[model samples]
Target: MPETTLRTTGIDHLVLYVGDIGRSKKFYLDVLGMSVAHESPRHLFLACGGQGFALFEPRDGASPETDRDLNHVAFSVDAGTYEEIKAHLEAHGLEVTGRRGDDRCIYFRDPDGHRLQLVVPD
Candidate 1:
């Protein structure tokens, strides 16, 4: 018998727990230009068209910088925006890395130390 698989269109949303919802919200809004789709006392949902993400207040003392788990979120951008994105991140005092200059993606971290990436569409 074959294993069953659940079909899905794509990622509808993503959630990230942050030490401070306001700080995280500001970072995403200011850096990525993500407008708030919804807001609550301890959560802010930023709309990214079909897909969006939420910044939620941390519980039980979760540490952002000390977390050893290696996870990152990548956002797709236009080819022309690749350089502009890199420049924007740098202008914001973010430490951006591409591993190699030829790489189609640049990696950086948010104020909460959450890894983020910007990749150009193929």
Candidate 2:
């Protein structure tokens, strides 16, 4: 076997298909504290911890669907701020789920139904 020479860097951004870009933008910016990098009628770009996420509204007026094969997107958070983050999300009426096997992470869904996670180092 020959050694591969191709190399790739980390994730540049994540694009999520949302039903309503405005609603999704509000949820991300207001709840998650993400900053707006760019936006349009059908798209919104959010910046989180230097990474970017694009919320795209489909033209067909269909709701966004999650792929059961892929679980969720996990964002890294400081261990000290974990409780505060949980509380903030809960305060916004978002249901936070704790994994049975992991105590250092919590899961929740965005307004568009995309699953997301906040995780701290063990």
- Name model 1 segments beyond 4 Å from true: 1-6, 60-70, 99-102
| Model 1 lDDT per residue over 46-78, tens place | 997568888877666666542763489888775
Question: What's the lDDT of the predicted structure labeled candidate 2?
Answer: 0.80
Give the range where candidate 1 is weakest over 10 consecutive residues by summed lDDT. 61-70
- Candidate 2 lDDT by residue in tens digits, 1-122: 66789766777788888888888888988987789999988988888887888888878786666654257888886544566777888999999988534567889998767889888565
Q: Under the 3 Å rule for N, CA and C atoms, how many clashes does model 1 have?
A: 0
Which pairs of residues collide in candidate 1?
none
lDDT of each: 0.79, 0.80
